[model samples]
Target: MKKFKVLSCAIATTLCLTMAPTAFAGTATKALSVNTDPSDWDRPNAGNFVASYSAGDNYIYTALEGIYWSPAQIDNYEKAYGRYLTLDLKEDGTTHSLNGYSATTTLPDPKFDFEDDQEDESSTTPGYGRNEEVEVVSRGALSDWTRYNYTANFRILNSSANPYLITYASQSIPPLYPGGDYNNVPGVNTTGPALQGEYFNNFKTSNVSSSNSTKAAKTVGILSNKVEVDTHSKSKKAKVSKAYDDITNRKQLEDYKKKHRDLLDKKTSKKDNRNQKVKEEFTVTFNTPVTAKKIKETISKHNLKASVIYARGINNLGERVTIATTELTDESLNKIINSKDYSFKGFIEIEGEGSVADLNNVQNDAEVYAVETADTESTEHDIRPMGLSWKLEELNK
Candidate 1:
C-alpha cells in the first residue's frame, strides 16, 4: 500500500490549489452581494471555520458562517426548506455524504442582530450593518478523528486541506428557496473575469484550458484539528495504563501468597515439634509502660529469648511496647499472666505453633490480643488486598 503523507494546510496547498471560498469574485451582474470573510458574518468570528472530532459521541463538529439577507430571511429559509449543511467527506480514497443540522424540526435560536455594543464598537468600519450573515453549526458521525477530507457545500473550510478542495462562490438565493438548490443557483459575474481558462486549467495544474472544460476543477483536502486528536490518543493511553496497573498489582499479590504458603501453614500448624519451637515467634504488647529492667526480668524468669521489636514512643500506641519471644509453655504463660509485679494489662499473640488454649488464656487475661501474621508480600499487597479488585469493578461499572 502506498503511504501517503498526512495532508496538512501547507502540505495540501503544495499538492493542490486551495482557494479561499470567499475570495472568489462575484459576478457584477448579480443584484445580491456576497461576503466570503467569516468575520463579516453576523456571529463573532463566524468565518473562522473549525473542525473538531469528539470521541465521546464519535462525531465531527464543524462550524461556519452562512449567508443571510435579514433575520426574516433565515426564518423563511428554515420554514421553507429547513436548515441543513451538506457535507462531502473523503475517507480512505472515497467520498461519503454525511449532512447534518439542528435535530429539532423548528429553528432554535437564530442569532440575527449584532449586539448594540458591538455595532457601536465597530461603527467606524466600512459596511457595518449592511453585511448580512449568520453562523451555522453542523455535526456528522466520524469513525476516527485521524485523516479525512471534508467539504460543506454552503460553508467555507475553516482551515484548508488537499484531499477535499473548496473554492468560494456565492449566489443570491431568494427567501423561501427550496432545499439542495444553493449550489445550483447561477453565480453573478463579478468585476473581473473567472480564473478558469485565463490563469489555470480545469485541473488547476497549469494555465491551459481544454475545449471541453469551462472552469477549474474543485480542489480537495482533508479535515483535521490536531489538538483534539492528540487528546483522544492520550485519553486512551491513560485508560490502558490504569488497567495494566490493576492487573499487575493483583498478579503480584497472588504470586507472593503462593510462594509464602508454607510459612503461613507452618505458623498455623498445631504440631509441637522441636523445629516448630525454634521457628515460633510471638509478640507481646503491654498497655502500661514496661521498663527494660522489668522486661529482662520476665524473660529470665520464664527462660524465654526476648527481643524488643518496637518501643512505646516509636509505635502508634504512646505507652504500648511490643516484644518478640519464642514459644512459651502453658505454665509459663499462666505465671506471667498472674504475676504480681507485672500488671499484665496487654495480650500475647503467637505467630506459630501455639495452642488455642494458650490464645484463649492470653485473651482472657489481657484487654486485647491479635495474631500478627508475617507479611512476606509486597508493601502494595500489605496495604489493601481488594484495592485492585475494587478499582477493576469500578472501571467495568
Candidate 2:
C-alpha cells in the first residue's frame, strides 16, 4: 500500500468531461451515510469538486473557474449547473420542491425528524445530526433552518471528533476563515472569552470558494460577493455526466441508493463480526409477485423507504428499511437479517444469493443498481461521522 499526501488547498482548472450515464437516479430524497472522520477527508481531495451555495434563490452552484482558469483565486467559477435541488416540507415530511448547496458537506441529514436532532452541522454549529431515524427528504429540499434551542449563541462546529467546544473563537485567535477573504480579518485574534451558556452575538458565517463565480464577483468581473478564505483553505467541484447513453441513465443521491442499498448493508460488518453494530440503510427490489406499495409498507413497518423505478420491471422493490445504527448490539442485530422480509425465499434474500458467491448466493442475477455519485474534494477536512462524500479527482485528468 502507498500513502498519498493529503491534498493541499488550492484551486485547479476543472474541465468538462464525458463519461457513461449511470443506470440509476440522482440524489433526490436519500443519503449515503458512513462511519468516517477528518482523517477520511484528509486522505486525499482527488476526484472531487468544489461547489458554492446560493441561498435565498434555493440553489447550490459550482463555478467553472479553477487554477487553470485564472491566476488569482477570485475569478474562478464560470459555468452554472444547478445539479441538485432541495424540497420544502409542510410539517408532514412530504417534499414540496427542489434545492441545492455549495459543498457536498453542506447537505443536512436526509431523514431529519425533529428540529433539534443532534447531528453536527459541518459548516455552522448546532447541525442536524443523524440518529436512529430515516430522514426522508426529497432532492433540493430545504436543509436550511435547523431547529435550535440554545439561544444567543452560534454553535461553531469543529467537525473534528475529539473537540474543544466550550471555548469561544476568543480562546483561539480567530482561526483563518475556510474560504473567506484573508486580508481584512486581522492577524491577532479579536474574538473573546464568553460565558459557557452565552451565545456569541456576531458569530461569523465564513463562506469559502475557489469557484470563479465567487472569486470573480468579489475581486474582478462579476458582482464579487465572497468572504476571503485563507490560502490554506482550498476547494473543488466537478460535473459528471454519463458519456454513453443506455435504456437507463445513472444518477447520484436518490438514484444511487435505489440500486446500491444492498452494497450499503454489505459494507456493514454483519454476522459474528462482533464489532459494534451501527444501523445502516439498505434498499431491496422484489421481482414479479411483490408490489412496490406492499413492499414499501412492509419495509416502512421497519422504517425503510421503497420505490418502483429502481425495480423497473421487477415486482416489489426496496433498499433499506432502516439506517445503520451505532446503538445496536449482538443478537439484537441479527433480527434484521433473520426477519421474514429477508427470508431465503424473499426478494432481498434472492438478491443476496445473486451477488454473494459462497453463502449468500441464491441466484445468478442481482437486483438494484447504483449510479450518479459525487465526492467532495479536500486535502484536509474536519468532518463529522457519516459525512456525505465522493472523489472527482478519481475521474479528473
Residue 156: error of model 2 in Å? 33
In model 2, the number of clashes is: 94
TM-score of each: 0.17, 0.22
Q: Model 1, 33-82: lDDT tens per residue?
A: 23333322211111222232311221222222222333322222223221
Cα displacement (angstroms), candidate 2, residue 40, comes to 31
- Candidate 1, TM-score vs. the true structure? 0.17
Compared with the true structure, the alpha-carbon lDDT of candidate 2 equals 0.20
Quality of model 1 by C-alpha lDDT: 0.24
Q: How far is candidate 1 from the true structure (C-alpha RMSD, Å)?
A: 33.1
